[model samples]
Target: MKKALRRYWQTDFWREFFDTFLNISDCQNQPNLSHWGRKISVLLKEDPSRLRETCRLLRIQDETILQAPSF
Candidate 1:
């Protein structure tokens, strides 16, 4: 049950992230958001722990994303 909840929330999370990314990127006229968004999604799936580190690195590459990864 706990694992199922985790999976459900994970799916919800990626969906929300993609939606938010597209909305903000579209507003800013960003063409590279798709690439970055996919990168983040994959990282979240592969290793939630490392996602924050990855986001930090990506922030260095592009600080446009107003919100950074949370714990």
Candidate 2:
């Protein structure tokens, strides 16, 4: 299950994420940006450990996110 999600991590899900993230340059997109931010916050809060898997799957370079709780 994890492998499959990682394999398609760059699909629609990531596309929307990157689009919202990259749109930070525009003030008008603040709503969209905050939406994603809240969503990420909720997910991380639910399972901090998933942060590491998320980083690995997304190829994120931030080591800080890996400090999430386990199990």
Error of 1 at 46 (Å): 3.0
TM-score between model 2 and native: 0.38
Q: Can you write out model 2's per-residue Cα lDDT over 1-71, one digit (the tens) per residue?
A: 23434425336656777776666777654745577788778756687667777767656433434755567
Query: Which pairs of residues clash in candidate 2, taking residues 3 or more apart in a chain or in different chains?
Result: none
Q: What local lDDT score does residue 44 receive in model 2, on the 0 to 100 scale?
A: 60
The most accurate candidate by TM-score is: 2
> What TM-score would every model get versus the actual structure?
0.27, 0.38
**Residue clash pairs of candidate 1:** none
Candidate 1: clashing residue pairs, number:
0
- Which lDDT value does model 1 have at 65? 41
